[model samples]
Target chain A: MPLAKRIIPCLDIKNGTTVKGINFVELRDAGDPVELAAAYSKQGADELTFLDITATHEGRKTFVQLVERIAAHINIPFTVGGGIHELRDVERLLVAGADKISINSAALRHPELITEIADHFGSQVCVVAIDAREDDNDWHCYLNGGRIPTAHKLFDWAHEAQERGAGEILFTSMNHDGVKQGYALSALRHLHEQLNIPIIASGGAGTKNHFVEAFEQGMADAALAASVFHFGEIPIPELKSYLCEQGIPIRKL
Target chain B: MNIVILKYNAGNIRSVDHALRRLGVEATITDDHDLIRQADKVIFPGVGEAKYTIEYLRNHGLDKLLLELTNPVLGICLGMQLMCSHSEEGDADLLGIFDQKVKKFQSPSTDFKIPHMGWNTLTDTKSPLFEGISDNEFTYFVHSYYVPVCEHTIATTDYIHPFSAALHKDNYYATQFHPEKSAGVGERILKNFLAL
Candidate 1:
């Protein structure tokens, strides 16, 4: 059988707690990171991505501890992102139990960082997260939590990222983020056509059909969202069953 | 059980350790031949370039030691590839524990990706390693190269072509998929390995 499409639950963490700002689940509303991670694993999430939206040097250590705690409970792949500035940071997170490391702003600043991590740890361990926003018929890449725009185009940077040895691309549309309308299917389709590596679509996932559209229209390998899964608006088991009924190849519970 | 996870500079070592911990086994991750040899069960898990890994093993004399391990040993991913006689990756020779050749996947068309990432089901799972794993249950896999089916293949997965998903020879067993990351099915497979 062919590989099944993946459903990933993203957690926007701040100061070692799941930040429920964008969605109705207030701060710490979805429970602790380790507890929520275990719940998601039991619900049959393909993987989990924990993004430390804001972190100081001390807060980074706390995040590592959180990763260690989560690792002890769950038995699935999880990626750690945000504030990953150096090779040492990646090393620390991996050693602390993160299966993969996701990088954005640092990668934009020093493209060689991608190659370096790939050379040292293989491409499978490094994920290049591209936050893109539409501007004048062109999707432009952004950095620093989608606040600063870059001169590099989305497709160009994605191509460059793969060339530099990124195993996958996690593309988030800033315009669609928190909007709960739908994914940027056109952008995702364009990327799927251009890149050979796996593409994970992120943002604007409100309903179960939004995920199906990601796979059907966007041709995404995985669909990731935070609020929908965190707030219990859509439980993972029900989502998987829905996707399976929709003829998408999902891991049966 | 005194489980020892042989460590090199491979990625996801912690993942394996964490998996065993979830199973209530505090597996030791060590390269010390003595520690590895003394363990009740040894797990050779790794994900890295074969050439560099082979070089490290040879330099540390682990290549010779692994060839002579008597206890039950389980290899994973690149660890499984390294146990083969030869690998096309980096043109590096391996431990010859399985007496097979590892070759990179050649796509018949452009529709297939090279690495073959994500979850896929396993077939012909006959080894004790998959004692409780249901047939065709999905397991996580991520690799560009694969070992063709042979007498040693205990499980097979079809992608571009049928390849060995799990291999067994006497006391040595290995899987190309990451049981540590395959969720429930994966944990069951790991538990089966421990029971063995």
Candidate 2:
């Protein structure tokens, strides 16, 4: 069988607990990170991602502890993001048993960090996540959780990141994030065309068909979402069955 | 049983330790040659560049120590690649346990992604390592280079084409996939390895 399209359930974690909200606001408690992670793994989630929504020094320490706990319990591959500033931070997270670390703002500010990470810990350990919003017809990259915009356009930055040795591109459409209509297929398709590494489509995953479109149309290697899976809007087993029925290759439980 | 995870300058060693802990086995992570030789089983697990890792092994005398071990040994991902005779990555020579060469995956077309970075199935499996595992069972993989199917191949997985998913010769065993991160099927594979 060919490689199955990955279905990753993302958890936005604050302090030490999982939280879900819209556009990174209106936060609400979901559940414990370790328990939720084990549940998702049992439900046949291809992979799991945890974004440390907490932004303080204490919170960062707490997040590391949480990562260790999740790693001790969950058996599937997982990526941890949020507040990854330097090579030391990446090293800390990986040492804590994270399979991969996602860097967004820090990567944009210092592109050399990508090369440093890849060179030091192999390319597979570095995941460059880009949070961008579509403006008119172009997509502009954002900083500080989409509050600040940068001069780096979507395609240009993504191309540059691939050149700098990013193992994968996590492209999250800020406009589609939290809205849950669908993914930005055209942009994702463009990324798939321009880059050689795997592209993970994030945001705007409201329904199972949205996932289908992301993989089939967007040409994404994986589709990631939060609220839908967190709130039980779409159970993973049923979703995998649906994708299988739709003729899409998926890992059955 | 005493198990030691041979450690070197590589990533994901802690992950291997964590996976074993979940299975109720507390493995000692070390590079000590005496400890590795004394253990009932040794896991040579790594996720890093083959060039530097092989160099590290040679410098620390692990390259020779590993070859002399008579007990069962399991290598994962980069560890498996280093067990081959040669690797195109960094143009390095490695331990020739498998009598094969590791080649980087060239995308035949745009549809096939490099790194093969997701779940894939194993076919033609024929080893005690896959005792309880069925044919075409899925395992997690994340690597750009692969060992082509050969006489020593115990299991095969097709990405660009058929390649060695698992290899066995004598007491030396290796897998290109990360069983530590492959969930249930992976756990079964590890249990089989321990039993061996």
Best by TM-score: 2
Give the C-alpha interface root-mean-square deviation per candidate: 1.5, 0.9
Candidate 2 lDDT over residue span A84-114, tens digit each: 9999999999999899999999999999999
TM-score of chain A of each: 0.95, 0.95
Between which residue pairs do clashes occur in model 2?
Answer: none
- The alpha-carbon lDDT assigned to residue B94 of candidate 1 equals 91
Among all windows of 10 consecutive residues in model 1 chain B, the one with the lowest summed lDDT is: B107-116
Clashing pairs in 1: none
lDDT of 1 by residue, A2-100 (tens): 778999999878889887733333435454888777778887899999999765777777898998998778887889999888898888888888878
Instruction: Considering the two chains of model 2, state its CAPRI-style docking category.
Output: high
Residue A13 lDDT in candidate 1: 86
Residue A166, candidate 2: how far off, in angstroms? 0.3
